[model samples]
Target: CELSSNASVSPGNFILHPSCDYDGLIPSVVFFLSFLLGVPGNIAVIIFRPNFQHLSSVSQKLMLNLVVSDLLCLLTLPLWIYAFLYMWTFGLVACKLLTFFVYCSTYGSGLTVTVLSVQRYLLVVHQKNWTHQMGVRLLLVLLWLFSIILSIPQLVFRQVTTLQNKTLCQSQYSSQAQRITVLLVEGLVGFTIFFLVVFSYTRLQKKVKQAAFFNNPQTTRLVTCIITSVFIFWVPYHFFDVLSAAAIFLNNEDLLQFCLTALYTVKALHAVNSCLNPLLYAFTSHNLCCKKSLSPKI
Candidate 1:
């Protein structure tokens, strides 16, 4: 979804009306703060890479990619804030380019989490093997390639249009069918991958509890927090997107407006995940290191 310009009085059929005229101001301020927090947090993760080297190769790589993806998404927020504050004065090409990057990064981060969950599942359920490491490397490459391919549609559909004497950047679908198709694709891909991640983690948790072997409370708690954080941060965004798309498909203006308003609020909440992730990492590292030091060598 794209950010709408504040100057546009009418919310349009696809857009939702905010409860107040200055609703955009709240989100803009939130986005600006998120950028300030997320950039530094993610950069710190990159700079402190050696501290995380104790994590498995796959886990380390996935965490790094996740940070990079979040950073890419966060980098586009300043542009979005500008659009929300004034208008999309960056012209057509910049609009498409920035939108493309945002979608790419969003998808990339989601897929990375899915892969990370699977890696953790494998580590707990199966014996370590060289082949698993090789497979993970290959999967990482495929995940990024798929994310880029999925994001190409955004570049094709997004346009900068003049509305109420203000230029706005948004997805300009030619038909409702086109919009539905895009929304369904995005929702399905994100939900499907996240579902699999949750399933894998659930099963892993069950197996770990059943065996009662190598069951570190700190590790278990950290994993639970990570999974919970992912769900809390992303589920609402996807749920609201699906609801908004359904409203559009049914031509329910009232429902569409409500969903859009809710979406506008949830979108900032979704972006907060990037800022929260670094803190999660810090907790995970500290807990795991302490666990390692205390555990008996078998």
Candidate 2:
């Protein structure tokens, strides 16, 4: 969903029922809490990175990168909250920049999680080869570049427009084809990455079962947490995006309205993923205090 327009639309214009206020209010509270929690949690992940001696591993590095992505997304929450409560006063430049960063960080986080799952699968199911670690830094650079490329559509399409004398920032598609194209790209990319992650984790799980590797419960727990967290936060958001795209393609106003209503709730859930990652790290790694010398397993 386009964060600015979908979220900042006046309740009077969109709310069909009296209870619609609850829908908006609850998710607004969720976004607020997510911002309060996510910022410090991701910061802690960076400040207290694992202290492995061998430059750590791909998974460790990916975790740090994941935090960076989440933090970038979270930094825009204050603006989001402001827009949700009032209106988008940030103008066109800030609007485009914020939306661009959100998309970049979102795509980055998804790719990072997918790659982390792949790294874990390899480590768990196959013999670790030095080549797996080769070009780790370069891979990260490419991932961010890819994320930027994925986000280019947002920068190109988003605009600041005045509505009812209220200035707002939102995506302004010139054509139905353009809208569907962007939505399809976003949904497909997210689903593709998540599908890979799920496949890798499924294989890893089967391997763990066959190998009876329950002796190290922490490893299994960590994998479960990562997979579950990513899936829970992202799947619904992408699902709604796909549905919204279909609604637009079909010119189904009812379905479009339903998708928009659901978007706010799912968007908040999606943002909560950032806040949950650090807690997942703490619980899975047994490093709640951040000073522990535990080897990074995820």
Candidate 3:
């Protein structure tokens, strides 16, 4: 949502929400907890391994990239909390730069995860020759670069706005048309990446059934964890997004209000995915791997 309006001449007229106190507190709490978990969890992943230097698998590297991005995203969350709790004290430049970093990190996390799945599918099912590809180091660099480029819009478009004498930090897209454009781009890009992931897995599943690794329950659980959360979290948000787009396109006043409210809740639920992934997918796999590594030799 557009946080505040930056039109200097008419500073106090752009308040998007009615109650800043309530709005500020709720998200501040949520994002604070997220930052707490994300920062330490990711750092420990790197630090806890004894042979961290030697450990280099395609999947592991991708996961590392994911954690790094999540950490970056979490770091910026405090700025949001600060804005809500106090005021837009950082001014416009800090607001846009901080928000841009957050968006970049977000895309990095999503894309890294998606690519990890594809990598797993390839290794497990296709048995393709992955060698001579410059390995995980190159891929990690590419992931960050891709994330930065994709998040360029957020950097270029976001700004601080003042409404009703309160300053808010948010991305600026003036009209419904612009909002739709951003939403559509996000939906299309996300769908395309996810579609590839799904398709690759579908083809891989048939082969997995015939492979020895498929017999491992952990493998099954990992696949299930990623796909289930992605669908469950993203689908509702997108459903509401499509509805919002429809209302805008159709000029349905009543539906727009109803859908926008619903969209707010759905988007909140979608953000929960960030926190849930670490607990459900990452921690579980870490536990499983540790168990196997510690098991007695036959």
Worst 10 residues of 3 by lDDT: 6-15
**Highest-scoring model, TM-score:** 1
Clashes of 3: 5
Top candidate, metric lDDT = 1
Residue pairs clashing, model 3: 4-161, 5-161, 5-162, 12-164, 15-163
lDDT of 3 by residue, 89-178 (tens): 787787667756766776787777678667656654555434444666787788889878866766666677666666666556667677
**Local error of candidate 1 at 260, Å?**
1.2
**Local distance difference test, each candidate:** 0.67, 0.66, 0.57
After superposition, candidate 2 runs with Cα above 4 Å error: 1-24, 50-55, 130-134, 216-221, 281-298
Clash count list over all predictions: 0, 0, 5
lDDT of 1 by residue, 1-298 (tens): 2333221111111122243336668778878898999999988888877457557666777888988988888887887777666767888898778777777788888888787677656655553323466786788889889998988876787777766555667777777777777767767776787687788778766655655344468667976887788787777767766876787778887776666666666677656777777777643544433223322110
lDDT agreement of model 1 with the native? 0.67
